[model samples]
Target chain A: MRHISHTDINYADLFADFRDPNSGAVVMFSGEVRDNNKGKAVTHLEYEAYEPMAEKMIDEILNAALEKWPLNKAICVHRVGPIDVCGCAVVVITSSAHRAAAYEANRYIIDRVKYEAPIWKHEFFTDGTSEWGQNCDCSSPSHPHHHEHKHHHAE
Target chain B: METTIQVTCFAGLRKFFNCPLTINLKLPTAYEDVLLEMKKVNPEASEILDSCRIAVCESFVPRTALMTSDEPLFIIPPSSGG
Candidate 1:
């Protein structure tokens, strides 16, 4: 399910759909908002998306991952609007016959989603300030190509 | 005839522009022309606009690509999604 949700994400319901007997390995990555970033105390996060393009981009990313790897299934869900600290911002799940494919495909999907999707994150600080978070600095020549993990943790 | 296109802004651009803005340009307008018009509307956003990419019909297009007035353009800043 490549979707943009306005409410909280239900991880249980997302995993319940994966009941393929042929799939022996499943990897899930969940990204949550943290209490601090860059030494600032973050109060919450506001996520916004160009809904149509964001969904289409996610679909493209998942399809690309499926094509690049031997995967049984791939799904991603991202939340928009305001989210509190420790709240789930995004989730990606991939299942395959073996652990390696599942793990690799899961990483590929999340990385592309963060770099390609038309979603933006705005962080609010405890000191009554806020700024737009930049997850990927690919456009910058001095920065590395990899995306900076902003509290993303696997589950 | 003049063509009017609506640009949907997000993140920092949205904070500066407030809402989707409409710009009038020539029939065969390039993506760069949109940026020029945006700069004319608000010079303060020029720095931010320089870092953005324009998407049309759900796909990212190059600066030299001709833009259509029928489809809305999305000004995407560096994505911060997980």
Candidate 2:
């Protein structure tokens, strides 16, 4: 299932649930909230999404991944709302009969989710300052300063 | 009869239009018209909205699309979530 959650993601539950007798490899990826960004001390992050569309898009990404890879199971969960430093923000799990498919599919799913999902993040710094993230693919191409700003490609 | 469309903003626009969480637009509206309204009400938001992407009925659409009152409209700022 693809989900946008407010609570922390449970790694143990995800790993256990993704297990399959027919699959020999299982790959899991987690995105964590870091304490520093662009030289500023980040205190926390706030995430938001157009819920219905976000979930639907995630399902589409998974479907694409399944078509491209021989997969046994796959699931992704992302968090919305405030997340503290070192906290988990998103998790992806993929299981396949071979390690290569599992690894490649895992990477494909996360990349599509970050680039295509409707979710957005706003960061709060320790100095009582906050800024909206502007690294999405949806940013206007006509803006003069748009290209000058560096984008944060989700890693 | 007059028609009003409800537009919801998230992330950056949320902080700008958070008091109501949603803004109303008159019928016979296009994406550009909405941006103009934002400029009139909050100039700062207009700057941000200028670079934002818009969605109608939960699907991303071009700024030139004409919108009616019954469909859901969303103003999306550049996303950063992973």
TM-scores, all candidates, are 0.89, 0.82
Q: What is the lDDT of residue A4 in candidate 2?
A: 93
Candidate 1 lDDT, A62-137, residue by residue in tens: 8888998999999999999999999999999899999999998888788878877888899999999999987665
Interface RMSD per candidate: 7.7, 5.1
Give all candidates' CA lDDT scores.
0.83, 0.77
DockQ of all models, two decimals each: 0.56, 0.52
Find the 10 residues in a row with the least total lDDT in model 2 chain B: B18-27
lDDT of 1 at A129: 96
TM-score of chain A of 1: 0.87
Query: Tens-digit lDDT track for model 1 on B1-32?
Result: 88788888888887678568998887787887
What is the TM-score (0 to 1) of candidate 2? 0.82
What lDDT is reached at residue A130 by model 1? Answer: 97
Q: What share of the true interface contacts does candidate 2 keep?
A: 0.63
Locate the minimum summed-lDDT window of 10 residues in model 2 chain A: A146-155
The window of 10 residues in a row where model 1 chain A has the poorest summed lDDT is A146-155
TM-score of chain A of each: 0.87, 0.85
- Using TM-score as the measure, the top candidate is 1
